[model samples]
Target: MKNALGSVDSVLLLGGRSEIGLAVVERLVRDGARRVVLAARGDAAAIGVRLKDLGAEVLVLDFDAERPETHERVVAAAAEFAGDLDVVVAAFGVLGDQAAYEADPVSAARSMAVNLGGHVSAGLFAARRLREQGHGTLVVLSSVAGVRVRRVNFVYGAAKAGLDGFAQGLGDALHGSGARVMVVRPGFVIGRMTAGMRPAPMATTPEAVADAVAGGLRAGAETVWVPGRLRAVFTVMRALPRAVWRRVPR
Candidate 1:
């Protein structure tokens, strides 16, 4: 639940080690979030130290995005740790190599399961808890690639498209429940996820994404675009003819 002054009292971050996710959690803690639950497959000690330095009570739980069966259990653990989840950040994904995915269809399928299937289960479970509490926020980190999936990375983009649509429909389902969902669509983020990848047009950073997310939460926005201009760029890009669009570039 939020404090009287509107500061988030507790938060649950699904991807504890994600650069963008960690940045958002740090921003939230700086704003006023006191209790935090970080779920990740690996050790989150480094992340824990940072949040603890920011004066937050942190708890870490083992979480594997590839396993949907454990999502409900993780959410319940978070709720048990911190009375009511005031905010939940669903940020976990893999920026897989398109060529590799093409060569190994099985790998691509697994990636899809983690990127899309995992979110579906986690988001729904969180929504259930939020609805029961009648107050909370779920921040879904989507990508502009979903708006217009390019051949260079269609596998990853396709998964994001599914996630974006799911987040929107889920938000609509929770209307008037006081448990709103905020969807963030950022362009190529130049961070750990894309360390050596070529920088795309209007590429943003994890920190920038975090800042936009914080602002969106404060404004109660359903959708937010990092740099605030990609919305217009994608609008035009989406209107291009198939032939011209395909020939534009990777």
Candidate 2:
């Protein structure tokens, strides 16, 4: 049996415990991915064991997204598990309280470091690996908030915007390396991360985003908008003048 992409044999998900990341991993496994490395903050025993039961050679690794210095070691560990990584998903992030962030610039900056800086370090390492191998996919979880900063979560949105731009530049840099990057911009995802939050229009689930990601991979798309309409929604949102944009309620 071939994987959804028809050739992916191994996968490395950075935020292994992430609901969206795991959903994508599950889909890839069904598609023929035989080996997987789920690297997260703590023991991924539950997820690893589950995948093991599914017939994949699962490896659990320690990954701290906030510690950029350790990113190379994490990538190295992935190489030790799978010689040629078919897919690498960067899906670690935090949705801090907007009010708290507004109160403490320090906290907001730390959030940005984790969300954007971590990706920068890990992505570079993964890109180098993929470029050397000459074939692989890097999946980046961006957000619609990044399309246009809103007053509700501008700090988080700004970090995502930085990450989004970095992914694009990295993609261009790897144009001829046979390494591709897929950016997923999903609208409000009512997952563990967004628990207790009001669902946005066209809000989707992890499964929905996973399905969209699978489709994007198959189509070789550089960017994917979950619910598929966010692309258009943001187009108009971005065009709205500052006065109207500022009044959006949190």
Candidate 3:
């Protein structure tokens, strides 16, 4: 639950090893979040150690986003561990090669299952828990690529587009339930995810995104754009003619 000043007391991060997700958790811990639950596929020892160092009661659980059937149990376990979840961050995703997706549609589908389908299940489960508790925030990590799907990475962009819409609808559904949702739209983030790739215009870092998320949470913002300027950039990009937009490079 959140304190009188709107500081969260417990947090559950779905993507335990995500750079941006960990950054956000760190900021929340600094702001007085005492209990933390990190759910990911593999080991989360380092993250647990860091959170423990910050004075948080940390719990790392094995979670497979692709296995939607297990999401309810995952949420239940997290809730049981930390009591009422103050903040649930859904940040699991994969940025697969577009060329490979074009060649092997099955791989693209698998990526979409994790990036979009998994989120749908996790978001709904978390929302139900938050609604039951009657107060909390569900942070959905969307991407600007979803705003205007480019030819360069249409598969990943399409998945994000679906996620963005779902998050918006979920937020609306939970409007009066006292459990709100915050959708984060960040333009090309330069982090472990895109390590060897070329930087895109208006590229930001995990720390920058985390800072923006922390600020948004404090302000009770529904949607936040990292670096701030990307909102304007995307507005123009969305209105561009298809012919001109298709010519833009990745």
Clashing pairs in 1: none
Q: List per-prediction Cα lDDT, in the order shown.
A: 0.91, 0.88, 0.93
Per-residue accuracy of model 1 over 1-250 as CA lDDT, tens digit each: 3443246889899988889999999999999889999999887677789899999999998888999899999999999999999899999999899999999999999999989999999999999999999989899999998988888899999999999999999999999998989999999899988888889888999989988988888888999999799999999999999889889787
> What TM-score does candidate 1 reach?
0.97
Per-residue lDDT, model 3, residue 199, is 96
lDDT score, candidate 3: 0.93
Error of 1 at 114 (Å): 0.6
Q: Model 1 — which ten-residue stretch has the worst lDDT?
A: 1-10
Give lDDT for model 1: 0.91
Candidate 1 error regions (>4 Å): 1-6
User: Candidate 3: where is the Cα deviation over 4 Å?
Assistant: none
Instruction: Summarize candidate 3's per-residue lDDT along 1-250 as a digit string, tens digits.
Output: 3454267899999989888999999989988899999998977677789889999999999889999999999999999999999899999999999999989999999999999999999999999999999889999999999999999999999999999999999999999888999999999899999999999988999989989999998899999999899998888999999999999987
Cα deviation of 13, candidate 1, in Å: 0.6
Q: TM-scores across all candidates?
A: 0.97, 0.95, 0.97
